[model samples]
Target chain A: MLENKDLLGIKNLSPFEILSIIHTAEKMKLRINNKKLRENTLENYNMVTLFYENSTRTKMSFTMAGKYTGARVTDLGVATSSVNKGESLVDTGVTLDQMGFDIMVIRHSMTGTANLLARNVNASVINAGDGINEHPTQALLDLFTIYEKKKNFKDLKVAIIGDIAHSRVARSNIFGLKKLGAEVVVCGPATLIDKNIECLGAKVTTDLKEALKDADVVMGLRIQLERQKGGLFPDLREYSQIFGVNKDLMKYAKEDAILLHPGPVNRGVELSTDIIDGEQSLINEQVKNGVAVRMAIIDLLIERRKKDEVTNTKWSASESFIQDRWEKRYTG
Target chain B: MAAAKGGFTTICCMPNTNPVVDNEILVEYIKMKAEREAVVNVLPIGSITKGQKGEELSNIGLMAQAGICAISEDGKSVENAGLLKKAMKYASMFNLPVFSHCEDMSLVGGGVMNAGEMAQRIGMKGISADSEEVIVARDIILARSTGVKLHICHISTEGSVQLIREAKLRGEKVTAEVCPHHFSLTDEAVEGYDANTKMNPPLRAKKDVESIKKALKDNIIEIIATDHAPHHIDEKNCEYDKAAFGIVGLETALALGITHLVEEDIISPLELIEKMSTNPAKLLGIDKGSLEVGKVADITIVDPNEEYLIDANSFVSKSKNTPFNGHKVKGKVKYTIVAGKIVVDNGELMD
Candidate 1:
């Protein structure tokens, strides 16, 4: 049993809590894949997405699972809303909290803004995205994907490839995979990758082929094009040549190894079109698992927080369940 | 040290800390510490930027009221151009001299020691002498424009010495300090990678060392600051690459000055007092570092002829990270009088 706290970033979690989230995410992902609804554990919980930034995939995927698990969802996408230009994010977080929102999912452009809101807002604030900082749920799904597909963390070599500098995906994956005992290697050009990851206890290299060579899982990093104005990379095409992991680079992986990408893939830039659509890629499973994992997180945080999960003798699986009481019409 | 207010004194502080002071809570911490631990009147040097992260400027009105000696971005240069000019204007309102670290970190990024033939031998990264001169030249011009009292710290190279000399010749309100290591020890001292030999604006080439000596001798330079950086032993007991730079200098400074300048004929002992005590106090607008009556009797008593090996175990600082650990040196601080209290007496600190 873990305390129900909004996990907006890795800084929000103690080492044990991260491991607990990953373990819970693993169980939820396994049961979903096995089609054995052990007990609709999460019931009658509501998680709101108060996204100031547009998020089509994350909103849709999490919404599906929220329905499956009997939770009400409120979404504010850019097309139907007026938040982009005028509203201050701090005011938006306060308004959502005032509206009896259980947990608010927020995405913003400022780094550390989510954590800042989490301090002020009464609701458990989940960071959907914060400019170049971290996306915890993505990292959770990333860990869950590896846990399910690889089955044994100690036996995996996950290589994070592409846009090593601008990708928060690689940063999150490095922390996620390393914690799970997967031998992780980050490979890209010097300009694209983080220079001080060695400080984080991860080996960083510029030779892409050398890193992909014995990888059990090759995760492609995304080139966030908007980061050009932020001066993250000098040029896109120049970035693709020196470090991009194309199909030829994919041949270096283990025979049973899988390819992974937290998408909006760059096609031929970071990953070859064949490799992204290839037999080895688990890109779709990653998106699918993101829902179950986030649901598990919301259930644990919102519903279970009031239930005293940490001090409870046992998790009761039923006392804090959100899946059983979730409205059937929401799912249908 | 004098009991309440009597005797000769030397040196001033430049405040640059972990959570640099810009508000009352911060300056008051320094004030409280100075009141309790310091015998002399403690004058806090408020940072130009609040928290001194070099982004936002601080309110000089509140800082001037806090009894700050001057305004500075002490250990780091004011990297921003427009902000610095504005800071100069604010500091001018309170008449605070803007002190600076003067090194451009981007240019001096990998600088591990003083760049010269010796750095080439030791295989350590060196901060080139040009790094200091270039920034000094820029600040001199900025001072001319903003007319801020620009002070250069730990001036080490011949190029910088000549520049400051020329700037003074042109009558710019620019003053500079040379460290004992800069004039006394050359780049050769870092050959064995004695971490004590390591410093920011690192050490210099022998010719550069001679130039700094000449500057100090000719009064082309105004002060001899120890740049008294203190650190713990755990920070220095490793490879030169690993050990933290900066010697625990507060207690060892006068000894080094006595040995290097007094004996070497580069500077007389009285000239040492004027530069270390009088000139710095006047420059920073501090009223305590002197021996005149009605002055806060903050004074240092010295046995200028005493000879001893530099040992760090006797130092009063919480940190043992000093480069002058085992060098032989002459003279010692016999007593340090703060205001009127005998803070240090007969080489023993009096509580």
Candidate 2:
């Protein structure tokens, strides 16, 4: 069982916890297709999706995951809410917590937003994404997809190419893969990569060929075009020719090597159209696994919450009973 | 006043407040108010720019005559070089020191903490060391050209230390101050995303902390002033990016210095006192640092051997925003006497 009340990042989870989450996700994936088995797993649970940044895949996945488990899910659209009128993140979180939200799935543009919210409220926070910080659920799904195919993480060479600095997916993946005993290498443009990323235990390289050489799993991060305005790269053409994952780059990897991209792929920017839709591409599978992983996370957290409540009730009952005996003895 | 409870007999108030204290009327008002109600001496430092808008100069000449100790464009640097040079020249003529808050706003970008491995790991924008160094270099050059008494406030980066050291070596009328946070904490403290750990010139790397200690030891950086900014709990208890900059430093400043500096043997207790008291008074040209015969009795009595954990809740300041909560520290303030009056008696404030 997960020991922490919140799933803020993969960095805080141990190797044992990583495998436990993945194993639980495997069971969830099997039950997800069978409506009868999936229904009522999380009955009476209320989940809220609070996204500060625009998202389609992550938001939809969490919503679907909650619905499949028979939990009431509400999408708190940031644009239409009081947040638009300048309600602070804490105020918004506390309001939702007061409304009896059991879990809050949050994505924000600032790093550590989920951690901040988790500290402020009683609800379990599941980080969808936070600025350049980890997107725990996204990485969990990617791990689920990889584990399904490879059946093991030991000795796997995972090459994550493109925008390693701004991509929270890459940060979460590097942290998760390293704990699973995989050799992770992050490749991107010099300006697109951060100087201190190697401290996370990932080998950083500018050479795409060096990163892709005999890789078991190859992941491509979406390069935000706005980064060009900041002069992180010159243009898409240069980025595509040098760093874009295409058929030519795939030749450097093993014949059966799989590919992954945290979707809405900027086709032709981070990955070529052929590679994104290729036989080895698990991009679509990643989306399916996202729902399963989220279900597993929500279910496990609710289970823990239930156990904690029972333990608290028992402890309080025994304390009151002892106090009653002391009071009677003194009075008599 | 909370300053009295913090063991400070005198504190130079920064001008970056509501309405921006720039004119003679405000300076006289502060002086009159302190005289009537304050238990501690309050010296008001007027702003370099009129509104701290950095567009034009304030009433430097008139404010100085009205008993202003210095002029500062603290909380930010005067972005305009020519305007700052002109301001520095006027300050020099008035015999008033320019306490510069060195920071290049353009270089800060959107950074909230020191730009390094820790910031990168957490995925927050970083404030590069050059953001501070470039301004430190610029101010030093301006001070040398204008011949004004330049006291750099809260020197954080190693590069800034090197710049100040070089300036002092050349005998430029340049001096600097380092806050307790700069010497004691590093960027690693920001890893937890606590807003209390967040402050301007954000806690730098370990090497910068080492350089700051060495600077104090060698008298390169001669003063220790608390950039004591207090804010409401609502302003601090939020997301790190949206939270306000600065922590309550007045209460914790002395204990942190004694524990981090004196106890570590980086500098002697006497040297710490000189940095905290003697040097700051000398920089401001005040007659109050030492307890000589016939001198005013502005003194802070400290039990250097007493050790205790810092509790932010126990702080007398309105805002309890401090990163050093529960931090085991050596030394405690036993008494604080200002001008022969017992203000802080046995660590408790007297009515």
* TM-scores for candidates 1 onward, in order: 0.54, 0.94
Superposed Cα deviation of residue B349, candidate 1 (Å): 30
Displacement of the residue B258 alpha carbon in candidate 2, Å = 1.4
Best by TM-score: 2
Q: Model 1's DockQ?
A: 0.01
Please give the RMSD to the true structure for each candidate, in Å.
Answer: 14.9, 5.0
Q: Local error of candidate 2 at A126, Å?
A: 1.0
Docking category of candidate 1: incorrect
Evaluated at residue A79, the lDDT of candidate 1 is 50
True-structure lDDT of candidate 1: 0.70
User: Over 4 Å off in model 1, which ranges?
Assistant: A11-43, A76-94, A226-234, A309-332, B1-149, B152-280, B284-291, B294-351
Weakest 10 consecutive residues, lDDT, candidate 2 chain A?
A315-324
Q: Which number leads on lDDT?
A: 2
As a TM-score, model 1 comes out at 0.54
Worst 10 residues of 1 chain B by lDDT: B1-10
